[model samples]
Target: KYQRAATCLTKDREALLAFYDFPADHWDHLRTSNPIESVFVTVRHRTVRTKGALSQKTARLMVYKLVQAAAKGWRRLKGANQLPMVTEGVKFTDGVIDAKNRAA
Candidate 1:
């Protein structure tokens, strides 16, 4: 959303420092729930491309197999420890290491 919704802040240092002194949660980056949902949508599209009806039990097994493969792929992505995509666009004067530092 940051790439698309570029918000510009007009506050000076005094006001900006006062605002960020409050505590904020940092859980958004650690969650994988949305990424998994995106993977599911892609897989569903692929599965539906060449499909036919099946017995209820067979359908369940097919879904399990497909999801097992997906889970394995998700595990392989655990090494991606880069910073989350920046939102609100942090501006740097100099020596800012991360977004939090610049925002402060």
Candidate 2:
């Protein structure tokens, strides 16, 4: 089991490093799936506990509203204003903008 785990980690090291691209304030959010799981929990519970069969449209609408409501309370991502710089291929190292990439 340990051998398999070590091999997997070695193979995915680059993917793991991708998380470092985000600012520190976003690390906890990136490292876990809790936020996504929480949103799905609402949909899953409603669908599973539902008594009668829902029409396709009804189920779709239910999920849509649930997700939209969930989105309402979401805070903006940290360093959101710098997102444009990121899109333009600016580089960050250890969550800080790289010295050469820093704007004057």
Candidate 1 has an lDDT of: 0.50
Over the stretch 34-89, how does candidate 2's per-residue lDDT look in tens digits?
Answer: 77888898778877888644688988888899888888877667766877876887
Candidate lDDT (C-alpha), each:
0.50, 0.79
Deviation of model 1 at 6, angstroms:
20
TM-score each candidate.
0.38, 0.72
Candidate 2 worst ten-residue window by lDDT? 22-31
The C-alpha RMSD of each candidate to the native structure, in angstroms, is 11.0, 3.2
Model 1 root mean square deviation, Cα atoms: 11.0
**Which pairs of residues have clashing backbones in candidate 1?**
none
Q: Residue 73 of candidate 2: its Cα lDDT?
A: 73
